[model samples]
Target: MPTITTADGTEIYYQDHGQGRPVVLSHGWPLCSDAWEHELKVLADHGYRAIAHDRRGHGRSTRTSAGHDMDTYAADLATLVEALDLTDLAVVGHSTGGGEVVRYAARHGAGRVTKVVTAGAVPPVMLQSPANPEGTPIEAFDGIRAGVLADRSQFYQDLAVPFFGANREGSTVSQGQRDDFWRQGMLAGLQAAYDCVKVFSETDFTEDLKALDVPILIAHGDDDQIVPIAAAAYRAIDLVRLGTLRVYPGAPHGIVGAYQEAFLADVLEFLAD
Candidate 1:
């Protein structure tokens, strides 16, 4: 497996495929680059170079007990991009990855970034505070942390039902799909997964979102149960200067896979414009 050494000396695994305009994908929390496998293949076939990396404690990357916060996450990505010497890149991030991309563009500067997209991203802050009354309560996140620590396997299994919107009355969820999600969740280290909860839930990206100068596309599902669109996706759209918002009605948080064709079309259109 190909890997890049971060500033903190952590070896992160990644996949680089195809050839054309470069697009780097970042996956959400508790999942690996495999989450973007479908998008990568589609983008690569459509004349784009696709690259994705497993975060420090997820997938095939080193399972460290520390450095699972947003700052470290963005830094690791910056290191990877610099190592590849990529320019005019379009960075697409989903869920937690969405927050990472926003922070990366703001912190590292957008000299090499051409465009950015955040799908079902948790940004502009997610945790509720006195100032941000609409954000998710910290208690909710505490429950998530406790659940994962108590019974990781069972908690992950239960998470799939809502994460993919399989709990919806007319939705269809396959055993294989659920198993694949579970398998990926189980592959990650416990400490990393636990710590990441705080990172994605509490890290404030308000300034980061406000600072991005490149074109940004915020695509989120209206029916997202994981990270509500109002507190996250919509908030990001309002903050970014050149951000465009697209809300998928009745779509779940996993809109990337659920509405693959439409999502790809929109992304291509944005990237083309």
Candidate 2:
């Protein structure tokens, strides 16, 4: 397991495979680099250098009780990319990872990156405010915080129900899927996971999205119950100067696995363009 030591001395675990144009993957909330297993193999086999990392306090990375915010997340990724001496690469982020990459591009500049892909990501903003009146209510995020504080394990188990689109009509969630979700969630530090809920939901990425000069591919499921396309992906596309939005019909938030083939094809297509 290769790891990079950030400026803060946190050992960030990551996977780098194959060669060619680098394609770094940033996994969703509470999940680790393991969540990108399918994408990693596919991208590598397709002659692309696929990279995925466990955010600090998640998976094999160092577990800490502090620095679990958007800025820290973006800085951790910047450190990894620089340490690896990667440039002109494609960054693909899902859910919270979307927030991380968006902030990374805005804060760190687009010199190291060529393009960005956001799938079922949280951007522009997830919480409602006077400026963004249509965002998800603050109380909804508060309820999530309350749930995690109450019982972390049970809370993760429950969150998996909707995270994978299992709760949708005609949708089926396998035992393995639920187990995988729980397994990854359990691997993360409880405090980091809790803190991320606020980071993803409250942080404003409007300016970040607007600042991006590279082409952005926003692929999101219209049926996503976790992060609705309206408040997240749709709005994100409008803000970016060069952005293409693709709505996955009847797709869920966990489209990485839920719509794996389509997701990969779209990503590859975007990168090739």
Clashing pairs in 1: none
lDDT scores of the candidates, listed in order: 0.88, 0.90
What lDDT does candidate 1 reach at residue 115? 95
Q: After superposition, how far is residue 206 of candidate 1 from its true place, in Å?
A: 0.4
lDDT of 2: 0.90
Show the colliding residue pairs in model 2: none
| Candidate 2 RMSD to the correct structure | 1.1
Candidate 1: lDDT of 169? Answer: 83
The TM-scores of all predictions, comma-separated, are 0.97, 0.97
Clashes (backbone N, CA, C under 3 Å), per candidate, total: 0, 0
